[model samples]
Target: MLVDSHCHLDFPDFAEELDAVVDRARQAGVGRMVTICTYLSRFDRILAVAERYDDVLCSLGVHPHQAAEEIGGVTVERLVELSRHPKVIGLGETGLDYFYDKSPRDIQQECFRRHIRASVETGLPLIIHTRDADDDTMRIVREEAAGQPVKGLLHCFSSGRQLAEDALDFGFSLSLSGIVTFKKSEELRDIVRDVPLDRILVETDAPYLAPVPFRGKRNEPAYVAHTAACVAEVKGVDAAELARRTTENFFRLFDRADPSRQAAA
Candidate 1:
């Protein structure tokens, strides 16, 4: 079984035929997925999907790019309060993105801190997003996690070895997406091999970062098998083993999944 730790099924890119997309994922051995909420206002859209799909889980938080768009739902207290929902298993898709800077950098940092605080308040993992802001991201990771302990995973990671090492050292996990399957991902491949299997998770980050052969195509949880294959090839392991290990690590990190949910699905 495989689990796509991050995807954006709520995005309009999949709105027309989302069920067909998910069906393809199950056929591809993707047993589970976690659809992300980029803006707190879209929480209901993501939540409805999680409630609709027995095998899908969702997170509640604001994305860095959407930080400036009236994030009234992601205040520290509000995040903690919403996390109380049974279907909402995690605290974010939050972090920095200096590359785009679509949202104010300072606001992004404040939103990131709120998520970390919420994670500390609620025993849940954080799904972080970072780009061209590695230094600030790692610094915030340490500073925020230091105040109160929390577990998190860097989603769609595309950083250097130092960032990976620092994240691991800080007790964070690293999730690889289809980007590792791209032609220019050699450096990322090396980093993938370096990350401990138990500390790794696989994602599709769909509607973005589509893997090779499917490059430039609309990605979904199903395509994670390709990313898994790419990671296994880099690490000199079988794809099934990679799938099994990553699936195990996925549940280990997102421990809120009930055994009955697994059995029911």
Candidate 2:
């Protein structure tokens, strides 16, 4: 079964047909999904979604876009406390986003560092989002990871080769989103071609960036298969094998969300 390692299921885009959306994902062979929390204030909504679905899990932390708004109230102690929840498997959709500059760069860096520290304390994987700020992102991550190994996924990765190499060297996995299926992502495809399959994961980042066939339309967990298919072609592996390996990679990295534990229960 394929796992959508990153998505925003609590977004309003899925509110009216949340059940149907999830059912479609199951029918499409996506067995699991991790909805992301972009705002600490709205974390309750994200947690509620995860709690309502056995196959759904979540990450807790602020997105870099909301850093300026949430930073005043966010604390490593608080993030750690909330992350104690059984359904929260990872931390942060947090990282630098220079592309939009939605939040002050310094604030974003600080927020990112706090999430990294939380991940270290909780031993949970971090779900990172970096766009147009590869250097600072890698710099901060490397500095914080000094002597303390940090495990995480670079979600919706469409960055340059240097960032990819830096991230892999830091022992973090790269998650491919629908953007990899776009026509202009040749550089990204080339980067994936060189990446070890074991370190690759696929996601839709839905409610956005749908794959080629579904491009320009609202995305959902079900479309992760299309992203997986593109990655398989890029890696020259069978699509099923790609799915299996990425699913394995997901569980291996996010060890707290154990499928075996679910089955046993």
Q: Local distance difference test, per candidate?
A: 0.89, 0.93
Provide the lowest-lDDT 10-residue window in model 2.
256-265
Q: What TM-score would every model get versus the actual structure? A: 0.96, 0.98
lDDT tens digits, residues 126-183, model 2?
A: 8899999988988888788777978998999999999999999989999999999999
Off by over 4 Å in 1: 258-265
Question: Model 2 TM-score?
Answer: 0.98
> Where does candidate 2 clash, by residue pair?
none
